[model samples]
Target: MRTIMVKVKPNASEAKIISENGNELVVAVAAPAENNKNPLMRVFEL
Candidate 1:
């Protein structure tokens, strides 16, 4: 398994990987930051 740093932007207009710097990533998701939903999963589904 591999681990990386992810910065999440919830409630975005769309889901996407905004930027990646080495092991760090900035991800945006349309899902709100609530209800225990995994924003990363939403990004992957797109």
Candidate 2:
């Protein structure tokens, strides 16, 4: 199994992840916290 580290930003207008020079990742998701949705779903969308 492989793990990629990512920083998550919840409730954004869009869902996406940006690489930061291979050292870090920035993740944004459209799903709000009130919906019982997990931000990790953003990765599945990729």
Candidate 3:
């Protein structure tokens, strides 16, 4: 599925991905080996 929207909040200790209508997608953040959480997620979005 293609992503309609994405948001990253490293400072707030959270990362969220919502649909076109404010519905959040289910995803999990793992350890540091992912080369920073947001970047991994961002790439996954692509």
Candidate 4:
């Protein structure tokens, strides 16, 4: 398995991977941070 660093932005208009550089990524999710159980998992799913 490979390891990657993810930065999550909750409550976005859509879910997507915004930027990726090497092992780091910036992710945006539509679900609200408070309501969503696992935003990081959601990001991974996307």
Local distance difference test scores for all models = 0.52, 0.49, 0.41, 0.58
Candidates 1 and 3, the one with greater TM-score: 1
Model 3: runs farther than 4 Å from truth?
17-46
lDDT of 4 by residue, 1-46 (tens): 3334454556777767777766556655576778766656433322
Steric overlap count per candidate: 0, 0, 0, 0
What are the root-mean-square deviations of the candidates from the true structure over C-alphas? 6.2, 5.3, 6.2, 4.8
Q: In candidate 2, which residue pairs clash?
A: none
Give the Cα-based TM-score of candidate 1 against the true structure: 0.39
TM-score of 3: 0.21
| Model 2 lDDT, residue 8, Cα | 48
- Model 4 bad stretches (over 4 Å): 1-11, 32-46
- Assess the local accuracy of residue 10 in candidate 4 as a C-alpha lDDT between 0 and 100: 66
lDDT (10s digit) by residue, model 3, range 1-46: 4443333433434444334433335444334434555443432343
- Tens digits of per-residue lDDT for model 2 on 1-46? 2334443455667766654444445555455667635545323212
TM-score of predicted model 2?
Answer: 0.32
Query: lDDT for model 1, on a 0 to 1 scale?
Result: 0.52
